[model samples]
Target chain A: MPAHIKNWSRDDLLLVAIDEGSSVSATFTQNTFCAAPVTVAKEHIASGSVRALLVNAGNANAATGERGIADARACCRAVAASLGIESSEVLPFSTGVIGEHLPLQRLLDAIPQAADRLCSNGWGQAAKAIMTTDTAPKTATRELEVAGERVRIVGIAKGAGMIQPNMATMLAYVATDAAIEQSLLNDWVQEAVAASFNRISVDGDTSTNDACVLIATGASAPPSANPQDDDYARLKAAIIAVHIELAQAIVRDGEGATKFVTVQVTGAASSEEALKVAFEVGESPLVKTALYASDPNWGRLVMAVGNAGIEGLDTGGVNIYLDDVQVVEAGGRAAGYREELGEAVFSKPEFTITVDLGRGDSREHIWTCDFSHDYVTINAEYRT
Target chain B: MPAHIKNWSRDDLLLVAIDEGSSVSATFTQNTFCAAPVTVAKEHIASGSVRALLVNAGNANAATGERGIADARACCRAVAASLGIESSEVLPFSTGVIGEHLPLQRLLDAIPQAADRLCSNGWGQAAKAIMTTDTAPKTATRELEVAGERVRIVGIAKGAGMIQPNMATMLAYVATDAAIEQSLLNDWVQEAVAASFNRISVDGDTSTNDACVLIATGASAPPSANPQDDDYARLKAAIIAVHIELAQAIVRDGEGATKFVTVQVTGAASSEEALKVAFEVGESPLVKTALYASDPNWGRLVMAVGNAGIEGLDTGGVNIYLDDVQVVEAGGRAAGYREELGEAVFSKPEFTITVDLGRGDSREHIWTCDFSHDYVTINAEYRT
Candidate 1:
């Protein structure tokens, strides 16, 4: 089933099959240039039903005019006809070069072979089939008891380059065997993704093909539809854990990323301000490069904070820490702060930066990675 | 004369003198954390009479609490005492690490020495002294006839990193021998900067120490102070030309930049939209890297345009070109486009990218540079 769609292959075409009559809820990229398949998927998902997904990796099929939409529709039709389902029941997805057409005939030809190899253990294979420039497959699973019934949740994601999802990642799929109401599943999918996938970044390029789909097969005893139920809360937590795990893995595997970084903004006036501060630090190239060199340059961090454009920001009341060692206290260098302490913390492969604005109790955190020369090399040579 | 009070040096103190009684107009960084010197310069320039500028390199004297203001005032005081002028008549500038106090004693000690070296040709040395990480001093001169009188305009600037001037560059000084009213000088300075320095970017990190000062010393027969005077237009044009030359030099010397790029956005609903779209493409790491690699990846350009947050942007109406070769027409790849054509254009040391929205008649342009591995290397190693 995992064929030429493998990473770095000449033709990154992918085909996969899933159970019929599955309950699915999904999220897609908010990028205005969303791909043709994203447009089709949004329209199809609005029907409140989905059975299968036909996805390819070589062409994103975006900005390709009316012809692109026709090709996506044709792909869905072929998949649905072969699987004995309605065309709208089969959602289509594409990722890779934008503004290119899909090789429909070749992709359709491989669907039969892919369907024959589908099995419960196809999660790992499917993960590989959907990858574009990703170096490794990203998958996470959790098993828990819901109302005394064994419930299982599995999630897979593929994003190594055009990251910084405004909604969800480039491509992600989560499936569960616990029965849940369609409406509740939709709400949980949105909330869970907002809490996890929306709180991480890699390159800050929101991909046009981003989509996250969650499916329920109802193969096991399920919890109540409402979160008021004890089992519902537990299942939600497990699902959230899977989402976070997959989200974090995307950052870890971020193209050319050398170090994992977590930025937490605390004591802001609101959650929005907290996230604004967090992104100001996460998306700053100066700060990222300094982190790459392990330079422990706290001034760059302060510069990023200043550029965050927070209104009425009391610079004098701000506090910044590299891990446990305080670097900036009350907006300036702490009285006894030493450069060596910061150097020691930043030299580590993973560290936390806590910025407390001391205005309110709101807090936000984001996971990111250091920018290195490899990042430029990878993106620069991607087309060549 | 400019002196080395560099950020990392043991001392980065500096001082310079100007003719007594100059009509001065100035602009400072809009960064909320504007440096202590910037705040004092803003107040001093409001008086329309400035005689000296005391600058340091090592510490930006920003985010340094009330003591930073006192330190800046002290430097100005010492300069004023030596020149027999009021402290308010002296402006201060500092560019280096933010949140660090100036070496008040060393800076005060150097004022007399700097004043002693003030010659008409001190422009060259002054440019070198104000540099923090700049590899070369940027200077431009223009001589023109205004109302049958010779008018000369000279400009010098220094900015290597953190060179995105939201208002003006890190530091730019333009002096003219044309007599003009205080109000006219102020209005013309704003207009000239908007057309020049404000349209260039390096890393998009608006520095805390940005300042541009324009002075008219009446050293030569001058044009009429009234804008309605025909000779005033020619003089303004010469001054604006000098500003652009000096501003473009900053981008040419952008930290580790290997190629210069000019991004032009046209046919938009408004000038604001044009600037948004232009910056979206100019600041994109993906686009910059592709340019660095000489890759004709127009899809990345399209992605940037889409992310510009333009309301009701019809992707089908957008057009893009690399140099003179049309890449995207009517939102998709131009019929005659070839990868080799883009590669050939991008392989050059400089080029232009023109984006046409085809929505209205508004247009805007920005000067930028390709992001390269050396950019990461330079910033990463700066602190070390």
Candidate 2:
């Protein structure tokens, strides 16, 4: 991530500086066994005017009890002191092994160096520093004309499994140089995440340290705050577009994953049911492995939908398709569908599965990666 | 699995006939998309007298719409006609591929042969006939003395993945010659299954065709039906023991499995919470793969427990052990615990993970298997 830092080193850390008077909105994981840094970040974000994000990698500082929280606060204080800012204004983030305390002294020593190295170019390193089992750093950028002003939005995220809606075990940061209200920023962060990071699965194991933060420097001006305004719509679209790209990148580079899949479930009775069906297909080990092997095993999709525990689900009204190949229609193998056609579509690295429950007008979609042997190799042999 | 009938054949079918007036009790998958045969079996079992079980493997008559139900009825009628019994006295079971109808003529032709081959010593063959991706046929036997009358119990089950509680995508048959009332037989079947077939998992997917049936031929006399009666208790204990053993055998031979694991969650606020914890650990891909590699990655267990969605879970009150080696104490690494010790325990073919939530008296446990490369290979490459 950092040229000066060892690529294989586990003691990775990053610092993100916010311009003076900048507004910040953040979302923290709701898991009870949250990392100490998550607890610290939540408190600091609540302080209203967060100055920076001080992140450390290698040890999650989770389940270390009270001492872990103390260490997290200490790291924040170190960063805050160096920046001449209040300790409560600094948010801390950590990823990597859980249940280990922070190397407090070593971390404190690095804060000054991390701050000294901070620059606009640091975005690349920042993304790389957050990775645990991830193979590559993920970053996305979008430029939109807001109120005739050049507005730039950049987003970065790191995740490799231990992912499932409810914020997925990931750390994401998005910063926009556009003037926006803090309350609106929080709402937009929630909205963007719901359509992006929140709709992806790598093994359906939600981590205990997921956090996403959005910062607006207010360096560039936007036209309006009204929802129906074209300028507001453009800004929101650009932010979500960048977030989706960053989110999709995580699924593409998922641990041990070789195929990127999208599960789209529509015509369900409700959004929740549709989401359940989409996630059921996306997160199913059977379905993921089939995609890994490029095997057109459509039956597993049926099994997953059935197991979604949806009340009064009518199998007879369900239809499934693998890309353009109609594999299952009206709850059975499509009349004209051949095994070879199904195989042809599945052999691709990217494909979409469409499931129509034929009940109502609800829909949901989720991105996922296949369960491959290399994923087992990376996760099983690697300590992350 | 039956020779002279292809082993690689997906068209799996079996029939077990009892001497007459046999009392039958059964459990089916609670998954909404129950197969046609499961629907038929439930109705026939309700008829109060089940003389035979007509099971088909390979083509699971599921999601085939109304035609699937008709095929199941046709199968039952064929078996009944050949056995010279009422069609309502037959319970049908189907396993293997979903959304495919049985080759009606071929299956009907085989029913006569299956009935002809039905003998007192066909328990082994019956077990073998029900296998899908299972590496080996699973069977267990129990002999007990009730009211001075010797009773024999034989149980057989076949499952690998798509295995979850209630009752898992499996076909298990347990037959006993002990005299018991039909009503008590149903009650005992539910109780025994709850503790046996319902406490093991190979994967979290619940199949649409899971069925477990218990047969009491009333050939030998057991005393009374009351729970206080020693004879009834003895008979119930013997049946459950065999059922559990059969269930465990399935896990031991889990698809791509190299290690058998027992996850025991204790001290939860409620039994449901404990079960949620146990299943979370058992079904976690990270935990299973770590066990597959014999790696002492206890953090995955922490991640799983934290993500179990348990309300107000206290990490500080948690303790974990790998077999006799305590890895976690009060939610952190034990003072005397070493990675090598955990490695030694995990390297074994079988081990137990004891998680003490340290909050309440409720407890639950489940049997599981490690996820391995072979599991991915078998599930991905093999045709279901």
Each prediction's DockQ?
Answer: 0.65, 0.72
* lDDT, candidate 1, A214-332, per-residue tens: 88878884544456777888888888899988899888888889889999999999999999999988988889999899988887888888888899988888899999999988888
lDDT of 2 by residue, B212-320 (tens): 8888887875554467787777788999999899889988998899999999998899999999999989999989999999998888888888888888777889999
Candidate 1 collision pairs: B5-B12, B5-B13, B5-B58, B6-B12, B6-B58, B7-B58
- Tens digits of per-residue lDDT for model 2, A1-384: 231222355437888889887778888786767888888888778777888888766777887778888998998888888888989999988887776667787787788887777787678877878877788999999998887889999988988878888974588999999888888898999998899999999988888888988888888756445667788888989989988998899899899889889999989999999999899889989889989888898888888888888898878889998888888888877899898998898899898999999999999999999999997888788763
TM-scores of the candidates are 0.96, 0.97
Residue-level lDDT of model 1, residues B1-384, one tens digit each, is: 334454344334445566765678888887766777888888887765688877677678887877888998988888888888888999999888776677787777788786675677767767776777888888999998877778888888888778675776678898988887778888988998998888888877888788888888877855455578777787888889999998999999988899899999999999999998898888888888887888878888988888787888888898998989998888888889888898899999999999999999999999999889999999888865
Position A133, candidate 1: lDDT: 76
Give me the runs in candidate 1 sitting further than 4 Å from their true place. A2-21, B1-14, B221-223
Give the alpha-carbon lDDT of every model.
0.82, 0.84
